[model samples]
Target chain A: MTGDGAPRTLFGKVWDAHTVDTRDDGAALLYIDRHLVHEVTSPQAFEGLRQSGRRVRRPGLTTATMDHNVPTGDRSLPMADDTSAAQMRALERNCAEFGIELHGMGSASQGIVHVIGPELGLTLPGSTIVCGDSHTATHGAFGALAMGIGTSEVEHVLATQALWLERPEEMLVRMDGSLGSSRAITPKDAILSVIREIGPAGARGAAIEYAGSAISEMSMEGRMTVCNMSIEAGARAGMVAPDEKTFAHVRDRPRTPRNIDALVESWRETLFTDAGAERDREHAIDVSRIAPQVSWGTDPGMTCDITEAIPTPAEFSRGDESRRAAAERALEYIGLEAGTPMEDVRPDRVFVGSCTNARLGDLREAAAAVRGRRVADGVRAMVVPGSQEVKRLAEAEGLDRDFVGAGFEWRESGCSMCLGMNEDVLGPGERCASTSNRNFEGRQGARGRTHLMSPVMAAAAAIAGHLVDVRGWELAEAV
Target chain B: MRGVATKYERDNIDTDVIIPGTYLKVHDHAELARHAMEGIDPDFHSRMEGRSILVAGRNFGCGSSREHAPIALAGCGVRAVLAPSFARIFYRNCVDGAYLLPVEVGQEAYESISDGDELEVDMAARRVRNLTRGEEHEIAPVPEIISGIIEAGGLFRYRVPE
Candidate 1:
């Protein structure tokens, strides 16, 4: 690795490259290459800048969008909620007053801030990025050192284009194997399995570099899904060392650099970890045996394979009474009986959207899964594309029609139902099979139970009216 | 012992509960203060009246990167948040804003600290003594990097002279 203790991991290399000042104490002022902004988190940051009378240091490097509180139902009318409308209007004023570019409503670029940064090629390899949303780690899929920052940090980045950050230790998780040959498991399952293995707060104080054959073979969309959940495991960020697949995705994207200069390619090549590079911790998973996963509890760690049973508190506790006590509470909140087969877990709603699994590839897979089948009786299923562009592409390919034909509501793009911020929400105590990231209590609605699964599985859940193992369900009947 | 400790015995307290999405549009600190911890404990705002510190279980501020979460707590008179662990983004936000000190403690220390206990936090000594119990518990010492940020009253004020 760097001949001893020198920066060796890809994260270390990028951190070293972008460092603006080395403080006496171990922290550094990192020059943020990209800063993404949104309605939920930026208004206060803009206020901070105004209070200080500071001009935005680099408006060109920052991008803003309206995502969290925006409605995905109708674009023709104003937001029905006053708070939603106010936040959207405030973001507009902030962007205009600061001369920062904002892809607001009706703009093709308007989407979840995390999704647009990568799709538009704003997220790049070996550069640092930050958004005031935890899922900003999604951009790390492109091998960028991306992180979620707080509102004050958002203001800091806006005012100085830099964030004072403490260097985190590195962890490398390698999943090597071919899953497609036997069973199909998407990156969503891979990461959920990882979080399940290492508890919710397991990777605290670490930046993870996902390596090995499986990660390299994953499509850009899959990598994004995996990296998007890095924060769920409490990792500062997650990267997949920009490879050919990563380069291919960014190449020719509308917002990417005009040309892939040879010099740039060579530098990106250097971003890889040197052979024998020492990691703070290393983990490996035999991905071949991994099945489609689903979270049964509020947190991401409380997941199991679809074929498995809802974990009993006794199984999770071992000898620890406190652990068992917590699991019991979680089970109570989820309203699922222990030792029950996952297949029997009924879901009243099936939501397919969020920064997590709302991309075009995700929609295509979901559309494929329920081509000829109809959503089960009494089940409400909806598809909110990650971005407006994704909706456009899905509609262009008739994917929207397939979903709509199957009784899935094909709606506009926004972070809908992922959190109950928007009007889209579950009635209290209603259970849902969701493609969104977090299943926290009230995330969908107060007392609403959410099972986190991949898009295909969620679609299958809609048709089955329960959590079904998509692997054996003859996924996508004759598209 | 100096300030009173407001104990919250819960784990994985996400940002959503700290400051719900409903008030995310409210930029006023005082307004946020009245709503802080209202989601999880409707009476928490009133309970935190004189206490300037919060003691909690692991993984406090676990979801979303809402700076308002910490800002809300800060406005509610929380000068420091002592937890066994914290979500990375929330911890960084606390350091960046100098809003509240994120004190790391072991599970033992977290359990030992009780509500209304006068906590005399000695950062230099890495010790927190509870006047109520007349007991001392060692806390995890923060890296110099973080303490520097706390001392400078935030990164904005921590700038080197141009």
Candidate 2:
């Protein structure tokens, strides 16, 4: 905060206070309040620490889990994939060696690191968090200044609990209008809509705070879903100003700061941007006509409304040769012809688990979508909960039964089929409706074409065995 | 820092291209190095051949927060990477891990130097000499703090208890 009584951006207040050392070149060393680690990016960092004989300087500040490579089914059985087993084993070994708490297989706390953080209240309004995984930006939902750090920076945080960061340019994304009459609009759609308007590099080198009525009315899970993909827009992080809803959502969590909960609450009240804070850029999205989004191209930004048609290369007005070439290639890879209706676009698989959409709320929405319908034949459909707790809660409510009875494989929790690390993957040349972030080539599997949609949309696709508009479509068909 | 350059012209060359996720399972540094830039250039390892310097377009390291991109670059014998701009995390990783020197040169320099051009970099002076072209290009700034970290030989050595 400036001493002269100037209004500060929410990012400014948190960032300025965390600046421990500022260099002449404007690079700042900011202290990390919390560090989250996952399997893939940590092994090399731990190795570097071992060579240096340095213990984690603040063990209490760091937490570890195995998400990206762990299996989401039948945990009692040994992992069939040898390399994945080894990666998970490496995380367990590194965490045990370093005295950091790990929530590994079968642990109640074990889940996607992003899911577990807010549930445990570790992600607070005024904190700064860093994780080796890019989706760590999800924690920014509670107004925390969270950003992804590379493994080397991971090691730096472990050694000193401080990371060198340059302050990012600030952008305000005001989701102006409501989804209007479309009650089916999900946060996944809202975010996909944002990405569509502003391409992948839209918010690069910036910090984004999502505002407007749509954001305010969104649930914590919805906010999580939105912030989880801020990295997809190439933003350093995305946040929502913590309001009463955020306060209520985080109030009684196991890790909510009990001692400082009140003090923190008071401090959080000051974290919102003032009326006249300077915003480097602002984009107002009038979402009245926005529908549940689906990406047809190779990237998240190449998207259209569910009612829209698959765009031809000519639809891309951008004059860049490389971008046009990339779009044309994506259409070829996805096997979607130009000007085809997005409706009834067939898929070989439907996946509903990832940090982006595997939460309980997502499950409930999906369960409602396929309550009494069986998956269409020849379409492989599966449901892997985001966390063990989500799975347990869903099972307690028999949401798992609704899915299993509907011919969906109700599995355990982890990042399954999201990045296609383990056995869960799409077959060659197969198309899938996925509720995961990122639609890059082979993201779901080798040579697999992915269509990014909401969990409910994925469920609808699985039941219909094609891209069917869930909008106004009857949930159950007559016998 | 000086070496002949192995050039890649595209922008947003992500880590997935640096070393694909499939090869990430293999731990051996040399093995990883073998696959570095294979996504973009299958013969990257053969092409680099210990050239020790890399020249590329803007946002050289873009997606996925993996230091393996730089680690694989280093393991393949790259000493310095010159780019007009770089993804933030990748830039920090270059300095923190002591993987390679990241020199921020101008776009003119990026377009001027071709593959196999020998180059000399003087960070203190903020310029690069294209020995092959017998010309010098003024680089944009490398953060003073970053230079300090590089001089101290990476983060681990930089913070050694005095």
Candidate 3:
């Protein structure tokens, strides 16, 4: 709330800071500061260069890691799966051949591509970043216009440090009021609830800036969780302006300016759009109304409060008939029925990791939810930390013990179970409550049904053997 | 091309569904194309032998910024994708890669174009001629700049004019 529209938003300030030139087409030729790469998408771009006989143009702006296909548990062993092994080796060979820095297995920095960027301070406020991974939007938490690029575009960026981007229509989604204690709302819940209210395409072609009292109060990690899933709602990206929390998180990390006053001043100047700034669309939500949300169908927008029932296709608006059909197909595939209470939807497995919700805070929340409560009998539960550093921190805080004690497999850091590239995958026909981004059919593994939920909700589901209201349990103790 | 259109109508047909994230690791465009739509429709690769265009509802290519999406479609011989809308990244990726041409038509256009309709796409004129219905519908042509990219055979080749 900057008084009478004098308030600058993070989006405006950051966009202005990074804009190199406005083309005749009204698109921006923005310079990217940091470019993250992973095994899955970088190989082709590198091969394209090899065929053309060109070297990586700017290795300084780029960094690479292997996450999408690396086995979660046995880093020492050769990848057990041929596809995973080949992808990992290809990234290693590509990075080596191109002279790009790579964080391989057993490295402290090795983890999900999105997790490592911010942790290493490579993703900074008022900067543009791109990766070949969709969750590249996760970096927008620092008020950067971070986005995912295609393999061809990755080569373009590798050759030229800048990208041609059409400026997206801007939207502001402001939240007010402290979340009610009984709501058990996390940033995951908040984002899911917002997506549920606004259909999947509600923010299409928009660069959404989240603001207001409640958003401002969240930690940098919480803000990251919110921005990470913005793409799920069909928005190009979501951002929260860099504030004291952002400054505090980045100050001690590598690459950030060591000077306190100068950093503060720079961040303050980067806050751009005023509260009343012109926007294509503006929405306001009361934080108190949100609860721990769970996706009832495939898309993130097909979400509801855990206490609610699966929506029948007939209940959908006329415009949503196709979506209703898709939902019906997804429900049928997931072995769930409409009109069943969402809380009654039991999961055979539980996963708590992804670029969307695998931060240290998410781990702590899951640990809290499972603390002193054993996982339901026959339920397969796993807690995969997002980054190596996140794993180390969790171990130092004894969070691993909480998860292990609750009968959950404490695994190494990677994008395990998020997009079944690695060894950690659900069995055929197994249904899981996951803290990942998408719940598309067989996304976790072939014939494995995924139910997207917050980490806390996943933990609650694991303990109860069903989708349960996380708020029903005492949560403060875990936090 | 002569059979009735086997329409697969769905909204938000994301790149992930068209080409899952895991297949991104494979560099061979042809091999990757074989797995296109494996998760969604297991026989998509085989079924799309000679399809000229894919008709769908809103927000096609909605997830992930993988260019493999357009490459996969192109390799599968799909010349055009006509949808009500498209995700910005996927749309740009398709254009930049010079693979698949994305045409934005109205919702009514999708409704009228039934499955198995023999169709011909004209990129220069930006129209889909519904041969079955003897009808013509205009679509948003690829921008001039993007048309140049396609003419040059993808972005890499386009950049090196020589």
**Predicted model with the maximum TM-score:** 1
Looking at model 3 chain A, which ten-residue stretch has the lowest summed lDDT?
Answer: A1-10
Clashes of 2: 0
**TM per model?**
0.96, 0.92, 0.94
Pairs that clash in candidate 2: none
What is the alpha-carbon lDDT of model 2 when measured against the actual structure? 0.83
lDDT of 3 by residue, A259-304 (tens): 7568678667655465556778888888777777888887788888
Where does candidate 1 stray beyond 4 Å?
Answer: A1-7, A181-184, A477-479, B160-162
Q: What value does the lDDT take at residue A8 in candidate 2? A: 88
CA lDDT for candidate 3? 0.80
Off by over 4 Å in 3: A1-9, A181-183, A258-261, A476-479, B1-6, B141-148, B157-162
The TM-score of candidate 2 is 0.92
**Highest lDDT model number:** 1
Better candidate by DockQ, 1 or 3: 1
Error of 3 at A279 (Å): 1.4
Interface RMSD of each: 1.7, 2.1, 2.0
Ranked candidates, highest DockQ first = 1, 3, 2
Q: Please give me the DockQ of candidate 2 compared with the native complex.
A: 0.46
Candidate 2 chain A least-lDDT 10 residues: A470-479
